[model samples]
Target chain A: MENTTKDYSHIKGWGIDADPKNDPTYPMKRRTNEEHLGYSWERPTLQPQTVEILHSNERPNVTAVFGTSTPPSGLSGMIRRLAFKKTENDYGHWLPLILADRINVVEGIIEDLRSGHVPNIFAEKGYKAEWKYNRGGLLRKAAVAAILSYGVVAYFRAKKKRKHNY
Target chain B: MLAMNYRGPLRVRASQKPMPKIEHPQDAIVRVTRSCICGSDLHLYNGSVPDTRVGMTFGHEFTGIVEEVGSEVTKIKVGDHVLVPFNIACGQCAFCKQELYGNCHESNPQATAVGGIFGYSHTAGGYNGGQAEYARVPYANVGPTIIPEGMDPDDAVLLTDVVPTGYQAAEMGGIQKGDTVVVFGAGPVGIMAAKCSWLFGAGRVIIIDQVDYRLEFARNYAQCEAYNFNEIGDPVLFLKKETDWMGADVCIDAVGAEAAGNAMQTITGRKLLLQAGSATAVHWAINSVKKGGIISIVGVYGPTDNLIPIGNVLNKGLTIRANQASVKRLLPRLIEHVQNGVLNPKGLITHRIPLEEVSDAYRIFSEKLDNCIKPILISPSAGL
Candidate 1:
């Protein structure tokens, strides 16, 4: 118990002896949800910086990192190039194009039915029908279309092999 | 900056402090022009109020000049002289929207207990008070009202807490015209309660206290009959006899937990810390009021329960009204009273000391030294 008569004149300002950290019962139970009290200390930046990622028209060399030497002839070479392209465009470029093609196919079917022209199932109307891919760099668009076409071919091939096994 | 630091019970000293900065978007850093020692502050000073952390600045009644405003604060601007209500309320809360500013939900997430009060303790939201060079006032737009033109800072300071509390005490009584009112505790609030009772058309008003000088001061200042409970044997019986055995129409408890009438109350409530500060005044108010009369309580007690005479209250069919003074709700009408000279809120200020001598101010006020009725702290640079 400190004496009440002690002169504190030497102390310059108030709160010199205030040690909130040391107080036994201190740091009183603050309200758990006081943050919602409309009072905030969050200082938002006045000007938020916007970063734009520019995808250059220059397509990345699809096989540069894996070695530029082409495999000798036929199926092996084709498989190498396909694998390289898959790795290079794996930044989700192919998925969107495949989904778009499926959606376009559905839309085209719907339009045929609406126009009362969907009569043939195995003619040029079905085989010659092409997916309308949206414009991009012509080479990149072609690559995206080829990726989807390959997926379809591979899927049919797998179905044929499964039928043979059965 | 110098501010009042609460060390322990009866232990406070002015010490060096840092200037408060804006901590929230709605906060305002107010350079204190005036602050006051309130009767309720005594609860914190004496360690009667639980969770009163050591080293906290202890002053709830204050008036100041805004030095800075947060980005979101628009109602008041830097350089505006403002009287900050003791209750810190966010104007948008459901309770605040309903004019119950003291029960503002958003301001103190501890709304289950009480709302944010400046400089009381952690239980009241841990907001540092204005017993310093500057204080950080949260929700500045809602809680602080600019002191009106030509109003004395003294009067403005009282309105921050004392005047509004006293006015609310009387308002809660539901005083009727030509009705007798008895106010317990001749402290500043009681005196103000006695005075404000007349405004509510109370035909007769009386104040009771154990202190002789306070009783005299209450009579002189409030213009009401004042009696020392020690001098008058059995305060309830005395009131009954004075009111023709019908009891007073309204009774108010202005003395909260630190009341000094009964031995058991003082022992259990004050000494043992078992109950909320002494319920002596509450008991007296309950017993002395007429059957079915309203008992207004502005006095503060702990969040914990007190051993009040609830059976007596129930049998008497008393309508007890108690709350932290909704200062904002009553401010507009109170300002009118101040403007018309119907209330002199500053008349209760009996001592004015510089902020640096706040410890001495606390001692004098706490010890009842030199007939101190109310002590106002003048900022060293306030030039008051």
Candidate 2:
């Protein structure tokens, strides 16, 4: 998943169609100023997140991430534009802020995803029926069955030889 | 009016800014006492939904004290305790009277389409959210419920969502008295649905989840039995046998997206539609409910055209009601249940953290760390 993140980061704005004319920035097709403002409202990834600092009296303290990825600080938003998206936004580039603020949030959210449809522990429904006998019991039973088979084979061989001789 | 600026996941910080005043006379200013993080809020976290800005407050499930009222406002007064259900429906609108604000006919703008709740997706309606210290509630007289005094916020918190949502879940399933109900997933909605089923007087409530912790938690509130989805081969057959081969009378899919657990995805690798996750709770609803029973699907669906078995839906006589929950309708009674000691809803809270630790809380909840079922975002007032 971390590797995928790196790959996705590389493939950020360019994705499949990277055109230079639309985005003179070379890596991505930069939108004009009017296009930037126009697209900002409709584009969900650009939506604002509200983080609440709980005061003394409020009963509910829910921090709503309206419609965006992890809420980066003003600085990381800068890095996202300059280093990745290459748009000179209002935010200023600060790598420390990016590392401290955004990366951890990204990693944590990815960790929360369920491995399967269900939680672990009861995963092996098939293995539940496998506990008929322990290893020791199975070995002992096998030994007894083998001895009985060998004795029956010896008896048959001797009886056949005796009948032929007679 | 207030404006919003999107930043990133778990990173929404309100701006030191304000917007123009409302032009309408019906609008009221609400000093928000408490706004909460919603499961829907996490949609933004996972990049499923996107927003335009960071300055905008995104919370809708809140308990607020009314600060200012418009001249037209009469049903509510200043200094009143209120809970905002996650929508902005004008009571006079045709859809509001019909209780279908998801498609309201009046006061909704942009091609006469419904905007959204306080802080939600664009399809619902785009308005200023209430996750801040204050919010200007439009059409204030309609959905805001005055929370009675002496009610604990912890108990009342679900009033905005889970309590009524639970009822909605069972009600969506058309749960009749003495009916056997099978709820898939035991999150807040699932647990609350089970409790509501018991309240509505279902014969049995089988809360299904693979989490031992959530299942254990359900034992306290739910009157019905519990089934771990991982323990059974075919959930359909298993639920049927539990119903004496008749299937559950009502199947409520409360595991909105993360259905059953992570196990279903492991076996099917994101394609096993039934156990895929709560994302397809509707599918499970159709599959788990009896042929002639009801399916109350509370789990939200993503953009995916499920090839719904029309033949099966017709053949089974299944009744389905799925969409945004109207929790405001049931808050008064839910508050009574909470206050009267009949509903000890606080037991489901698995973690309590200072709201500053929201990013951490999101990690714990998402990762299922410590089997965290329901974590309450405790502010200073709650004394976490």
Candidate 3:
């Protein structure tokens, strides 16, 4: 949580629901004691963890059943570990984790290249469908990419010419 | 059996797969009849949700005919046309006893929050979805309800998720008579939320989205005010201005993780993978609602945290309620609503494609092509 000293007392009806009775769902929402009437059948046996499972820092244990097909690895795994260190509320926890996923995609492409396999970037990104179905948006994206590429090339060429003049 | 196979992000194909079998004594095998691709399924398809493994079939909202039932399953029998609620709840759980099936502790016990959701992802529970010709429905007695006699199969399929989820979104708002309600996202759920708000006596309902076609569709279907947020400068300011600066009494975030309209949110959350999808809709909801107003969230977000305005929520004394819709809880009333012509669940469908053309269905829906509002898949053996 970000620290803040700002007072919110000026806000109208601030803390109006601070009183338990003032709770909007007061009468309608109540704890039922029926929770004790738990599972009738024997609980299913816990699926054995055959791969690395990432869990929240708040949880003391991993879920009984988790997908093991995509275990975290590479740079993304390290960042995911860092993310899990902080509670789910913090930006520090999420941002680095997201950056890791993007990096992991690059890592996947590089691995594909290393294995002498050419990845179909277009089909993989679903751009073929975009061209067919969402032609306008696809063309707009293509135009932006072209303009950006041209600008980068022009900037580098001009820089080289300036160096020769110097 | 042919099933929609998840081949990572932005990829799904109809492929051959072994027919699903009952894994537990309480389980039943359902040969799906009507299946719909949900907005949340797009999150998994776009790779926004984590642990969506390759080869996983991804359909959660489905109505099917029971093929076989396990020994322990007594309430449901073979050949019964059943509408399976996406939540896989064990009827014996305390939450289920309280009618809070979506939060059943016995289901998806690994997660601290929501219960097991069909086809959501591994994070949801590694259960396969109904997008295939057949599905394994666990805890059969608890979640699968028989399709009411004479109910349209299209309506039955949607009752599995969309209608219930949309109705729950409005129900959570606690909309008093004549409360001004603002709904974010003009997707199928958002449109349904906007329409359902009227049932709670909302005087004015306005829906916001970036897509023009969706806004147009919402205007007609929901019979509510609609606007493109991209055209209207700051959504918070615009909503506040429209609501006489008092802000709407209730605001709903129907657009969850994949919300658009904010550059920072998109780059950090969607592109860079900083936050869990974009919190743009959530941010707008918090800022635009009246102080002490209720904000209902039905939008799907990653299990992980996203950047949200907690301070505003505290200072404004806002009430926030969110969860996966407990479909079983809402189904009875929603079915009545459908029967009475109060809600046209099937009217939302704009495209009907065969299960074999699922990849094209995904592309058409994902890209918002042909003005697609909702798409349903028909099994090759649907009538059979």
Candidate 4:
């Protein structure tokens, strides 16, 4: 595989300390011949990659040990692939990735509902702690949620009443 | 084995747990001698970080004596005194090869960003930390460095996280000679960042925080100007005035999600969980930095979208470099600094509590009681 290293040399002082001599703390950091002692051992055997792994586009190959817990799938997976296409610095990359996470949470809830288990969102979201420690904040949030929900229901009910009068 | 147990937010207790054993070929079991409750741990304790399950241990900065090693572990040996870097990196990964140990691809491959970190919740990989009698260290060959001969264990424990993090915060700033650096937050990392800024030839260093004792500590320890942001009213404007309206050359956000100054940020980010912890310091940093100046963030924010002014970042042409400190990369030079007496890693410790009273340790640190700058937990089994 070809090494596709990104050139960030356009940025001023980029990789300035790539040469150790340029480091401002060079006076204090004397070179000890033993710097490599701990790092010189044989590499460990690679864990086999059995799951669908999503890696940054900049990398040439998958890492030796990749996580297999959650593979890219559904809408969030597609968004993640799109996210990986852009460099990390771009807002385009991060915003979509965050959106993907939010979508994944909703997907998880739907999946839980599909199965026999009824997800206890209150317990799962750590609301018990919120009620215990931050009762005022939790109450304020509940009040706001209640008002908004009531307004929506009232609006639709008034619309139905108006049609009947016509 | 006695370990810190996570009951819930603002809740931790000392509980008996089974002694850790080598789970992988590259693992090592260390009997923890010293472990520090990090500012980041408070994020877990405060319920700021997601996926921080109940019954999980929370600690990342630790030093210990190796008690056991896996079959494949060669560099580290049993009975060796060592300090473990918070990052868990397989030595051969592409990122690790480039000395970007914090972003090691293999360690936390489930996440799109950041590698595995011990006891940093499931978001950082579910590796139990060293706030116990024993800890299981994976990729042991790459992460654990033997503490140098005669190095104080207190200093050695800090080297695992705080020293390297603060040093890296300045390094990432790419500070030039005589540049003015303004650090936000006067916590250990912020104080260390201010102190290390001088090593990078910073002409002036100013640290900002709301806490009186911490500001005083920063003023004395870092030998830099320090101010209470609450007293200053507008931190960005004060920084601008201090720099003669030119703003600072570099601004660092050592305070992550739970910043307190901004009411709106506190309400939305901390109180409501609208966005990852408050980006208040980040907002201040971006606004106070000179156009084209650098902003280095070593603060631990949740892995989510933050409300920040990207328009200013682009218009000001500010350079932002942020990450979990690549501890392995910075360890050697930091160890040298400690040896030369240039950086006093142990002097940061103001509170030392036994591992059994881990709950009180968290409460004191969390509430900022006793003018605590740093706190270390002494394991009962240490030196046994």
Native contacts, share recovered per candidate: 0.00, 0.01, 0.17, 0.08
Q: What is the DockQ of candidate 1?
A: 0.00
Interface root mean square deviation per prediction: 35.7, 17.3, 4.4, 7.6
Better of 3 and 4 by lDDT: 3
Q: Stretches of candidate 1 above 4 Å error?
A: A1-166
Which candidate model has the greater lDDT, 2 or 4? 4
Clashes of each: 8, 63, 1, 2
TM-score of predicted structure 3, chain A: 0.66
Q: For residue B368, give model 1's deviation from the true position in Å.
A: 0.7
Q: Candidate 3 has which clashing residue pairs, if any?
A: A98-B273
DockQ for the candidates, in order:
0.00, 0.02, 0.18, 0.09
- For B173-243, candidate 3 gives per-residue lDDT tens digits of 99999999999999999999999999999999999998999999999999999999878899999999999
| Model 4 lDDT tens row, B26-142 | 888999999999999998888777545455677899988999998889999999999999998996754576677787666764354778888886556656788998898888889
Q: What's the best-to-worst order under TM-score?
A: 3, 4, 1, 2
Given candidate 3, what's the lDDT at residue B352?
93
User: What are the chain A TM-scores for all the models, listed individually?
Assistant: 0.23, 0.21, 0.66, 0.61
Model 2, global lDDT:
0.55
Error of 4 at B316 (Å): 0.7
What residue pairs are clashing in model 4?
Answer: B257-B277, B257-B278
Q: Which digits, one per residue and each the tens of the lDDT, describe model 3 over residues A33-83?
A: 454443343444344566676676555655334433245677777876676
At residue B312, what lDDT does model 2 achieve?
72
Residue-level lDDT of model 2, residues B95-181, one tens digit each, is 344455433333322112232466653323345665555566766677687777777666656577767777767766656678888
Off by over 4 Å in 4: A1-43, A46-166
